[model samples]
Target: MTNLSQNSDIADDEYLSAFYRCAYGHLATVVGTGHQPSRTVEIGSGRGLARLSGHSWWHSDVLPSEALTLRNSAERLPFHDQSLDALILKDTWHHIPDIEAFLDEAHRVLRVGGTIAVFDPYWGILARFVYRFLHQERWDTRTPQWSFPSTDPWDSNQALTYMMLRRDREDFHRRWGDRFVLTEYQRHIGPSFLLSGGVSRRTAVSGAWLKRLLSWEERRGPWFDHFRFFHVFGLVKQ
Candidate 1:
């Protein structure tokens, strides 16, 4: 198996190229149908996919990089009040040290009726097993709270998203009721992520097979919601 680094160019590798194609295909669908904001920004956007969907987006990350439009933390956005129409966080919220502060910032910057779309790992049985044994991240679902005890911006508890959206969903609604409204929540893409090998591992499936897998997933995803590995959520600022 080949190791693929996030910084390295992935277009040359057939498997990695196919992997990104399939992954971005799902994200593109969300951008096209779910929320198409005129002015949007993606937090923690490492080699962003917003451009692929033909959306005008400003990319920001905690670390400075030539690829990013801005260097900023999620907790403190540099934009003005009600300046943005949408905020997209793909696989990012889990790494944030303080999610509440991040959400507050998102609410402050987004106009009323503006959307916050998040696509992240969902802690299902297979996902929990994979994260615990195969991945290099923490997967403690019983971690008393969502926020991890870390000052580093990059430090993370991968299970935090699952806990907040699935286990402690009501708590999230109760706390953020005044600021935001949960619009859409759904489990998606069961084994496709594993087969893709993500950004760090060798791909296990071909591009053709991945497309077939995604099509199959679309038809039967709801039936196996309990076993799906990812969550796509949409929230509107109120």
Candidate 2:
């Protein structure tokens, strides 16, 4: 996993900046805005949603950062049962070595009506191609089990989110549906992001122009759905 500059205003190209900014905004809206309680926790603090949110959020990460409120893995949260009102995960969800274990911990920590917001990669046409062939991470949709063997926190399956929520949704429900409800799911397009070259390089314009391009993508909707690269989904504990 790329260590996104922890500061909200990292030196990202305008396109990438808008892309991540929207994700953090969406995440903040879900975890805050009276949708959930105030004791919210964002698991990945690097480029955290706390900066965008109006509410105070406890930040945590597996990485050793003095800034983090908690330095822990997803599978083993240190909070007391039902002590948390919400849990937010950005790009970190796919890197967990055990999906079932993490979900179990998530279920244990959050209150009955608590929310879990996830902002991660989507399996759109352009995303599938770029992640599988161009990106360094593994994107295997065919993996039968949710667990992968990875000792390194950076190791990941980019398809993990897509698999649990889209492809193998039935399997997920069969296993954990009774404990959680899928309250919201929305796809996002980032064609301009392709040119921004992420954090590695730059080509797409930034600032007002990049914001305009992103607005254009949202306005176009279905016309660009095939190229969507990320999604924001919320789950409510039951």
Candidate 3:
């Protein structure tokens, strides 16, 4: 990537950092002291959006270290049964080609009362339109209809499947309801104008007006909630 303007990288890092900070903060709220399991794993810790924590085990797809572990595929996690206190899948569920198998494995490995937390886009009215028009990827309210192979993960045509929302909480509840307890639900809107691209010289200078526009849209109206905005859900194993 080309060198961006001063503090551009910092700005991006801060953006990701804030995401992790907020996720962990919310995860901590519902997960009480002992409710936290002996181990914590992050399924797709790409670029470290959700940092490894000190309280429990930390793992990611990148940045391997003694404290952090890496897994290549979500369908088959590299761990034993009932071994984790929690598993965080931040903005990664839509990318899982075999979400059913993946969640099944999560249920099998999570100790009774273990937590499975997910953060992803909810295809409400705003989300559906923004993703379909604003981005190249098409928004599909359905799940796993597109062909997704296990070995080569990136081969999917929908490179950025941002539109695959889980329909509703009751939907996921009906699936994992027996095995896990749904604990929390929260929503978020983001740096709307920032979009997702490497900063270039032309757009290097961050504009105050751009930030203001984002601020305005975040509080735009109650109708905004009807759109596919960001959402977080946490479930504890039964």
Candidate 4:
């Protein structure tokens, strides 16, 4: 197809592109609307967000790439205290080795009222099953601490988001409630992610059909606790 991408870093398939488009669009509204983020930075950004830069932001990751605006670890963001207006993460929060450490840095760098918006794998019933068995990432909800063992930065717990925001929210609030507030939580994404095979594998789902699925999910997404696959949650620095 003429629309197909040749870059190894960006989603090549139509369905995956549509998914990222919808997901990142939702992310933009949270990080962009109601407030102007003069210094927005997206961590573990990969290359997906660069394709749709209607708004402005810096892309960052631990590994340097032609696509990224900066290179730094989440646990130790290089920006000065309260310097950034917002931070965003897409499919990257789960990869953090230490959620608390990253949160600490997130709190330090983000100005008061700065938003941190993320789109990541959810822990609904179907999502839990899919992430634990169908996906290759680690998915342990039983881990006693927020940090996991990982020499490789890619090692991750797919359940990290759920663990912190849902299962152990009390602990999170107790530790850093005064600094950050979970302001938005919308858990929904149908089989579009799996059908597209993400950026790693390709499936031939047409863009039109993918749009229908996403539209359907939008109307009937309240079943977030059971059937949905992904979540878009936002935190505001307090």
TM-score against native, each model: 0.84, 0.88, 0.68, 0.90
- Report the lDDT tens digits of candidate 4 across residue range 1-238: 0122434344444555566777887788777565554588889976535455354578788976666778899988989999988888988998888888998899898888889999998887877888898888899988877789888878988898888888888998898888888877787677766676755776677756876887777678475447788889889999
Model 2 lDDT, residue 16, Cα: 55
TM-score of model 3 vs. true structure: 0.68
Candidate 4, residue 228: lDDT: 81
Which residue pairs in model 1 clash with each other? Answer: none
lDDT of 1: 0.73
Model 2 TM-score, 2 decimals: 0.88
lDDT string for model 3 (1-238, tens) is: 1122332343455333343455556556545565543487777655443333233435555324333456467778788999887887766676677777777888888888888877665555656566556654445545444335544443332322232224344555665678777667666555442342212222443444444444565565655666425666677888
Model 2: residues with Cα > 4 Å off, grouped in runs: 1-13, 35-38, 47-49, 52-55, 204-208
Report how far off residue 166 is in candidate 2 (Å).
Answer: 2.1
Error of 1 at 2 (Å): 25
Off-target runs (Cα >4 Å) in candidate 3 are 1-20, 27-38, 52-57, 62-68, 142-151, 155-174, 190-224
Using lDDT as the measure, which candidate wins? 4
The Cα error of candidate 2 at residue 225, in Å, is 1.5
Q: Which candidate is the best by TM-score?
A: 4
Alpha-carbon RMSD to native, per candidate: 4.3, 3.3, 5.7, 3.1
What tens-digit string does per-residue lDDT give for candidate 1 at 153-212? 667888888788778989988998788887667667767667877567767467567657
Judge candidate 3 at residue 225 and give its lDDT: 63
